[model samples]
Target: MEKNLRLRKNEDYKKVYSRGFRFYNKDFNGLCLDSKNNGPRVGFTITKKYGKANMRNRTRRRLKEIVRLNRDILPNLDIIIVPKKHTYTMDFNSLNDSYLNLIYFMNKRYKRK
Candidate 1:
């Protein structure tokens, strides 16, 4: 079974969003960052403005699926995905491609030490 990388706390989310580098792609939202030696982790952001509880969780689940599926292609960097309200309508294929592209984009910007 594959594990889902997760952002667990308010501080962690804030650090990734405010301090970590970001990419806002047409189909996805991303924040890529150094882990300061704790290895890679990930987080998801879905606001109530997106919809009710189900909608928010659905966005999160989709993001987690994309990341989990492409784990091997990714580098050792923290990531966060903040879904736009329009994201709920996106199909899995678009989400997958967009997410993988975002990961590749991040990989290009940050070289492992």
Candidate 2:
């Protein structure tokens, strides 16, 4: 999971949280995004509330894959994916769609504001 393409560093996380605009969908416990111009970066967070170590790791892996796959469609925006308690039971396709859905939501949110 740590070696995943979309995973970000500590400093990157801080920058994204500090500088990026955000909007999330309810189905996504995780985030997907492209790095911004030295402004914000993509990021992810999985709390203990998600599950045990394996489950958390799985969620991270799923997010990384989905983000990596959709890299082209995303913008240079910072994204932070947080997992829900039930995230463990979700299938990969659902998890994948969650990222797209959230990004869609964010794009719409940005368009409005």
Candidate 3:
């Protein structure tokens, strides 16, 4: 993902976590807030509880790839993804499905606001 398309600053992540609405499945939790930006921007967090640095990095990479491929599904939002222990073991297709399901739920919830 490009620099502009990522929520890179500590303040940015803090703002999203503090103000965004949240959603989750068995393996991941997502927080999203509306943004004035023309496109969606994303951030990822995987705690030490998940594993060592390499394992966390791998999970982050997987999440980033899923977002990159499905960017069009969400726009004008800032999102943060926090993966659970199971996320490290889930297959790509299952992970993608979980993500899409969360997005769909988010969309529905947003529309009601």
Q: How would you order the candidates by TM-score, starting with the best?
A: 3, 1, 2
Residues 12-111 of candidate 2: C-alpha lDDT, one tens digit per residue: 6766566656565566543434454543344678877767889888777777777777876665556687767776788988877777887777655553
lDDT of each: 0.76, 0.64, 0.84
- TM-score attained by model 3: 0.91
Top lDDT prediction, candidate number: 3
Which of the numbered candidates is closest to the native, going by highest TM-score?
A: 3
- TM-score of every candidate: 0.84, 0.73, 0.91
Candidate 3 local distance difference test against the native: 0.84
How many Å off is the CA of 79 in candidate 3? 0.6
Q: Model 3: which ten-residue window has the lowest total lDDT?
A: 104-113
TM-score of 2: 0.73
lDDT of 1 by residue, 1-113 (tens): 14335667788778887878878778767887787544677787777778999988878887777777777786777788777778789898987887877777888876555
